[model samples]
Target: MSSTTETFEQYLHNFIESDWLSAIHTLLPEIHEVDRNAVQIWFRFYPLSLFRYLQSAEDLEKAVQGFAMLGRYELKDQIDTSHHFLYGHRYWKTVKAAIEAEAVVFENDDIDLAEEIRQLAAMSAEKLKIDVSLVIAIAAVGMMTLNQTGLENFKNAADGIQKPTGLMAKSPDKIVSERSKDDSQGVFGFLKTVNKKYSIIYDEKRNDGRFAITSDQEIAGASALDRSQNWQEKDSRCWEGVIPVECLSASCGTCWIGVIAGQEKLSEVSRRERKQMKVFGYNQPEGERPFMRLSCQAKASGNATIVIPPWNGVFGKKIYQNVQDVELEPATTSARELRKVVSEAAINKAE
Candidate 1:
């Protein structure tokens, strides 16, 4: 039920990372870019480093001490649907049960993780008549759920969701094909406006969740969101954009998104954007085109797919830089203690 055991420590060696996730693209070139990118985005959404570090720590309480604002508990609640954006999401219920059964064998170190994934992927593909590549991605999602919530809680989710929601009903091929469509040839196009129109899928949950962009104005993607009447109902105080944008500049970090597919379609990160991402503690602010990006600063060049994180905050630098200070020595720190520690830290900082 807990990760503070030898089996989990051993399993950590074969753990998946961005490198391995990226290599899957080469291994399964037939896999649609949407499925591939969704897997990667899922990894970014639930960072493995954070999982491994906490599970392996001598004291779980101290490990989670200052990360209160990071909402570690909140993430585990959605572990099951984390990969809902993947093409084969419909097969998650079957996939999860398979993983739960295998998790016990993993604890005994009787089977290798990769071999199990391949076998599960093959069986699920055959049973559901879906692609094994997609199954493999969903299997990784199962493993992620187990890793964070532990086996007991993982098994507790047996009933599973009744079905896939929203945009999931759309064919993946349709979403992929829509990327090539360009609507820049209207009257606006003739008037030297709306140049090189591109489609951007922001909320994969909804089939209608997208907007258009043109090369004419070098405006960022969030700014472009406001231009589209096609988006969902409007909101107040945030420029009526689907994606929340406060500063319009990257300073607020409210409009960040994970570029699930078509990373190359977006312009490279600007100096200001990179600095703000790290300051907000998004993704260590690494690389020119890291998957994590500030939507307000990212300008679309061609069609792209992105997922807006459920929440945003400015705790990256403050929390990560000072994590070591809060680590304590206990494997059983209750959630209340976690909150108290963070609350006290806040009070001290205020003083």
Candidate 2:
């Protein structure tokens, strides 16, 4: 076996030997609280090999990139060509299925198979191409801290503790100043603190709805336009799929915008959003601007605005489905049903 593979096997051994597995399992009751039976079933066939594979990668960067490639290929193969897999939900389901199927297995008795499984997990992580370590870390911590609670309570706890951003600190001045003076009369309280630090603007003509874009000053003149309108019309040439949005909720990743300039003006990160973003491969360390937010989730306080990201995707689920479809080509009934649902949804939405 390669040195990298060996190292990952060792890491997996250490993880299982350490309290991590038991801790995770204990927390599983809390983590899978929402669907105890389902989660229990899933745990029965957890892909230890995939995890070990991820642990084996040279570094987190390689692991993430490899995971992304694997995920894309897998998705292409598994999902029915005619069906569309909603990104997040489908990918997760595929992972669960892979585990259940023991397709990526680690023989509990064989040390070599264990090592191989570690390598596979690392490969899977690389395909994801995002910081899976962060998610794992978050999950670890969550399990450790909130394992006693039920899934719903655990989720609520996560929501409560998840910081909006790493930059925010507890300060009375910062806290009080951020809120509006007129708390009773204004819908502007959320924007108060945010606007003072960043220039905010409303775009009505484009999406036929209100959305904010980050200003050039806040974005440090990264592009030619200092204002949101100019950025949208003249400066937003680099982006594709830039369009108006109807729903601001997670219902549509359509309003998925990027922080070309001021990412710091947005609110603190939430666990759910963070997980979702990672699954979509949008979170980056260097590009960690406060401005990188979904316009709908990002409420403007003062004058914060932002440019759109270059691409928008709804394939978290599709990627995994692609892989499964390829493996089970002869038994295409499930694939057909998925494709039909996706096609119908797409048609309905387009209409």
Candidate 3:
């Protein structure tokens, strides 16, 4: 590598700065064509702004919801329009834990910290494959910002390894597979009208394949909510790519989503969606079409891939206040404990 490149990698030691992402970019120097598209999607996770909210969130679920709302109500001139939402939501807990483990390992006298980090990254790549870079990148972000106790908590969360499920991800694999079939005709070939379908792959797990969008319905309208409700009504099998929904009129934030691809083809963010998105703390007055959109409001115009957040809420200005509270906490405090305090405070308010 050139002297400038070596210097840049050295600067990456302080992973807090948004500029540190450039080092991550350098890691993927030679890309295969098949992996090219995935690389672009991964690139979206950098520059920190795209995912600063990830740190602000108290838990994996809130972090997922926050990013989903941001994507659903994407502004035309939004500042952080990146695909970090994809990998961040999926592997955040694991990666956060791994980083905390790194911190604990940092305290060890015999371990080679740099070598250990590389080994962790390599192992992550071997295991998670598609999402390893994202995992390492986000781990870098946490290492830069978290204090020792917070790191311990993060490590604890990772060690626990009990993954949280996002509302949009409650789709049944069998139904998704049945729907994904090339159904040029009915189950018995009696129906002959071939529907114009588009593909939408959820969760970034490519082996899982794409969910067939048989119509131009918004993701919420076309999702597993329909099948879930049907199952409730009758003993029917639930379908896949289902996002949580209530009121479907942009009244609830449950159906919020982040578009990782094909944002241009989705309908423009309507005025009502924009208003709700802001009320939900999903968007700022930066621009329109900021990659975040309500799955209900955003009618897919073509094929796309999206990431569903784990939870949703209606905090409005209070969301900003909550963020402020997190920021004000002493760096040495355990993040897990702070989250518990926040959760308790919220519950007390409800009571």
Candidate 4:
């Protein structure tokens, strides 16, 4: 068997986009479009740098503990389900169990990870009553779990942590169908100026997650929520709406949402949006419109679905302290003060 170190770094490196994309294509006919996007988003969100950071750590516990956002996120255990915010997460436990059983029975050191996952996916399909696509994605998660925490921890199951609801629990088909829903009858919509109305499914438990954006110009943040619902029942400060928003201007970072589907429908990520996301330590990579976005800044022109992270933090300077060339644009009073602190630290190092 490959050492845990080899297995962990192997997938992060050579597995590459093409490898997973290849799997996505092979399973396209069997997997729902939503589940396919979930795989793509999972790969994007859990970056290679994260794995390298963990792998190269002299002390794993310290590395995890010293993380800028440590304790801010509930990802202490079940390393495999780190991407659970994506769709089809409900199938993870079943898929991981089956994969573990196979690994034990074979004890094959030269195991082809991809082929092994594919075969396990096929075998679980009949019993799980779920699509092969989802099983395939979750199986990959199982492999990652094994590589990250070993089989002993993988089998223990996560305890006491409460995962997000709605999309994680729903079937892929139902999640995808949400995007096609519309209720817009606006003059511009009827005239084909824009999609009449786009539904934003944030949480699907009892329809608390779904909302209609009738106006093409409306941003999917606090303002939109207020327009759609009566905020009188609860304080609109935060978590009062389907998508929480502390500052509708993207300064607070509370409105960031992961694009589960329909990312193309959302407006392009602005320079300001990119800056805020970086300072918020949500997503630091550069892309025209990343899977991670500030809901206060993204306006939808078509149907879309998104996942609201259970937590948010402003730790960009700490997280990307070593990253060079990327200039950070500070927002809000607190973030600007944070910049000053970082600047002082840099000056101290130079001295």
lDDT of 4 by residue, 1-351 (tens): 435434444443455434554554565566557666556555445433455455676886654444422222433364644665545466666676676666555544455556766777877776787557667776665565565565566667665233546544555677677555655566655677644665776655445557767545445452345445664344333444566554466655556677767777778888777766665556434577666788878887776777655555444544444422234345556546445433332222110
Tens digits of per-residue lDDT, candidate 1, 1-351, equal 444343653464455554345444444554556576676666666666555555675876754554343322334677666666677677887887776655545454545555555676777677778767667777766766676676667766644563655656667677666544544566756675445776677666666677766763333443544655633344332344667555455545556778766777667888777655654546633566667787767777666777766655444434344322332222223323444543344233211
Better of 3 and 4 by lDDT: 4
lDDT of 1 at 256: 73
Which tens-of-lDDT digit does each residue in 8-94 have in candidate 3? 233334344333434434444432222223333333322233344444556846544433332232211221222233333345555
lDDT rank, highest first?
1, 4, 3, 2
User: Any idea what lDDT model 1 has?
Assistant: 0.58
lDDT of 1 at 341: 42
- Per-prediction TM-score to the true structure, in the order listed: 0.69, 0.26, 0.46, 0.67
Best first by TM-score, ranked: 1, 4, 3, 2
lDDT of 2 by residue, 77-154 (tens): 222210110111222322323232332243443343333333333443455663332123222222222222222332
lDDT to native, each model: 0.58, 0.32, 0.44, 0.57
User: With candidate 4 superimposed using the best TM-score fit, by how many Å does residue 17's alpha carbon deviate from the native?
Assistant: 9.4
Per-candidate RMSD vs. true structure?
8.4, 18.0, 13.2, 6.0
Model 3 residue 12 CA deviation (Å) reads 15
Given candidate 1, what's the lDDT at residue 349? 28
